[model samples]
Target: MASASRDEFHLIVPNESQSAEVKLGSDVTIPCHLSPEISAVDMEIRWFKETDCACLYKKKEVIEGRSYQGRTGLSTEELNKGNVSLNLREFKESDMGVYLCQVISEDRTEEIIIEVEERKDSDGQPVNQSSKIQGRQVHLILHESNRTWGENQRMKMEESALMTEFEVNYVKVLHQTIFKVFKNQGKKLEQTELQLKESKTDLERVLQQLETITEKFGLLENKKDLDMKEPQMQQIEKQLLQITKYTEEKQNQLEEKDTQLENMSKQISEKEKLLESTIKEMETSKQQLEALRQEQMRQQELLEKKEQLRISELNEKSKYLEETKSLLEEREGKIKSLEKEKDRLNEELQDKDKRLKDINAKLIQTVREVEKKQNQLQGKHTQLENMHKMLSEKMRRPENKELEASQPDEQETKSKLEK
Candidate 1:
């Protein structure tokens, strides 16, 4: 159902309108991205070669369709920006075919098709293209097929990069916000502590003043007893009353300062608890990021192995191509020899035809000469029959004997003229 929905965004192939051509035994990336360029970090990217699923990215990890494995990948950094291109590490003969890229989101799913074609031969023709050898069709095989193996290394790289990026950014922002809160609270607490210290100093000064005043009042009492005067006694009593009232007020001020100190301590304790929780959360995030980094490193090692395997494969392929080249050269020589043989056979047929034409012409001339002789014989036979008829007529009429001799001479002359 999501596949059919095209509500707000749609996937598109940006490079070409119809298809893309990638060389055999080479790398290629089929570009597909979103129309409005929204983040695709949370979306699923799936690639298929015709009906077979070549790669699947769902639930933030790869699963099933290990067909392409190490040689294929998608860019996580790009995926975050909605570019879900499929990369092919090494293209093979079987790799040249139609491929589909599917992107599924929470609200919509879209797919696009790309046709990857094998690179043409050095002669600008496909290696599978039929060739003519001695006027017969011959299909040539020119390249060697070699492949590498591993888990989907490309996907691993992208996943490690993108996933880690998101986590790091999240943790950093959280750290900054918490630090700001702590800084403000700390400033407030420091100010309160300073005020409490000032209040303690003021209370100590008040106690010292009260002790000095009491000592002076005792001296006045001794002086009043010795002088025994009314004015002196009244002055001492008024001074005592003022001193008592001032001391009581100082005591109340000290109690208020004590209350303020206690409250400040409680507030500091609450902030400390919050700071501890935030630090623990940051540590947890660090642990997760570290795990992803380790996974990325492992994937990197696999990639190195894949590269080594590819190098060995390339060497084998080079050797295979050399062997194929030698075979083609041998076939070329054979084809050339067969062409020479065909030419020789054609020349012989031409000569035989010419001789047959000459023989037929001579036979026709001889038949014409024989036909001329047969015509002469037929005229002589007619003349002889006419002569016999004249002789019989002469016998019937003895008186016409001289006329018959003349008729016989006429027949003989007529026969000679016919000849």
Candidate 2:
């Protein structure tokens, strides 16, 4: 599987060593050039350490990770030309490691090693030397100022002059280097400060927006409170059910009473035409039956009116229920709309959080760079002081040697006079 995967991927890095050296407290680029150069615009380029512990880019925009946040980026201008170099700021010993740059679009990957070493003094030596004498390997003796000694002195003088000239040139180069670094640091610091201020303002604005969203949510909650409660609707439905049951019972009773009255009318018609002997008895019975009929008629009228009143009341309650249902439907729609709005606000809030994180990372990286530069400046200052002290000691040595040489000549002349 590994072999097959390797065959599908091709990237280019320096063949020999692929190692770039950088001094501590400085910035450096770890190059990962593309083979068969082509425009890499919009390509997903990722720079990572130790198999992707830190991510430097997702595409054109840099992706800040815990380790490389604010400290790593690409040159936006060069990206179009296929330059995928990872630029790391404030190089330190901790940063000396292998980094990989993978081009996801092209399915290619490359690695570069960075070596971070300490900065040397102006003389290209360690800066902890206490005195110039510690650097000397041998001592010299003085003699008379004769022709041979003078020739030797002249030769030494010429060598000293050459050494002085070289030291001066070295110091000049060092001065230029320090000056350029300082200038770059100043520009970076100013840029960082400006970005920090802008980010602070943006964070404040986002907080305000979040507060507004919270307030709107509170208003929606209050509206929900004012709407009809579900428990109340249930209670109304139960009352309607009881009324329908009672009305059905009353309708059944009225239907049974109508059937009974029809049967009795048939009996009365048949009996009225019976024999003359039974006519008198039937008259008495008819009179009593007529009175009962009058009473039943009155009761029927009252029941009919009561039934009509109940029907009307039922209809009115049903109408009210329908209206309440419509209102509930409308409220449901409104609640749905509010929910959608809330979701949209949540998405916006998430986006703002991501922006804030990116800004914070940049700020942190900038502060680190500033501190590194300040330390570099301090080191340079110490180096200059050491160089100045060494130069003064050198000047004093030559004068003291000349006095010793003159004293030797006087001693030889006094010995000759005694002889």
Candidate 3:
């Protein structure tokens, strides 16, 4: 039973009322097509009259029961397209029972019950089932003749609207299997209300018919009191009772449909509120995305500016080192030349020591001046070396990676300058 209910969710069948009225000995096709149709050629289809199996079809061949051997059959081609409309050639009294259509697809089984009734009327014609119990989400039978009423145009509009509702539902299911009711809930609520109004009208008409039938029953009772035919009177009473029961059931079903519509309206309101909430959340997410983009742009600009400034500082430091290095070399060369001249003068003055004592003091003064010049040159070279070392250390800092890459070349240049 649990499996059957689950299968109904997957397998949509057009079930009106459980019972179908047909003329005695008439060929009746009970429509049982699967909605959102799929191929059912491999499924095991069986029609059982209570406990006795009427017909059964496996994969290849169809086996008929002794009770309805020639009478029961299913279309092989229709089975391939998920349609298993059972054909009862001669619907007899024995065939009028609660027959179940048990279909085995893969592993799960689904069964739907429908009754085949023989209508006993004056003309033996089948009574119209729609006029009696059309409120049940009874999809018109597959390829059934279109029933035209006195209000042809109005009836067509109602049918078209109802069919549109069904199609819309099918489409929604196709699009989204979950949260499906949230979509077009408003539109569907309106359609349900329209159907509800129509059902009310139908209920009123059935009420009037019931009242007229009650009057007829009273008349029949009066005739019996006056010595009317027993058999005829009893038959009429039976028909009237059946009609009254059917009408009462129909009225109840119509009322149920009204309740269903009201429930739908309430659901639509809830869904509408939910939709509004979701839209607000979407707007919030959009705003957050925009803020993140702006932050990324701002950080990128800051990085670029910092990079440009570092490049400028690296160029200036490199140029300053080059200039300082040349100046150190030039001063060292001049000091060395002055020292060589003073040393030669000192040697000459010593050779003429006895004769030029007065000139010796002037030579001593020149030697002192040359010594001072050499000492100043040595100090400048030491200071320049210290500055160069400090500059190289600063270049090796992590943030100056690009500048540090050229540190080897700068070191080689310093070595050459020292040489």
The clash numbers for all candidates, in the given order, read: 1, 0, 0
Task: List the candidates' TM-scores in order.
Answer: 0.29, 0.25, 0.29
Model 2, residue 272: displacement in angstroms? 99
Each prediction's Cα RMSD? 26.9, 65.7, 35.8
Per-residue alpha-carbon lDDT of model 3 for 251-294, expressed as tens digits?
A: 67657666765686676667657755754574476457557656
lDDT of 2 by residue, 8-38 (tens): 4345544423333334456766665555555
What's the C-alpha lDDT at position 140 in model 2? 17
Best by lDDT: 1
lDDT of 3 at 409: 55
| Model 2 clashing residue pairs (backbone) | none
lDDT per residue, candidate 1, 1-419, as tens digits?
A: 12332356777767444333434456767667787777777788877665556666666665334356577777777766777777777656566666667777776767666666544568987654544222322222212112222355434434443543444455566567667766765676676566656656655666666557657666566766446544554665565555556555555655665665567556656656765676567557756866786788889889998998998899899889999999999999999998999889889888878888887887787788778877877777686777768666665776567575667677776777666
Let me know the TM-score candidate 2 reaches against the reference structure.
Answer: 0.25
Pairs of colliding residues, candidate 3: none
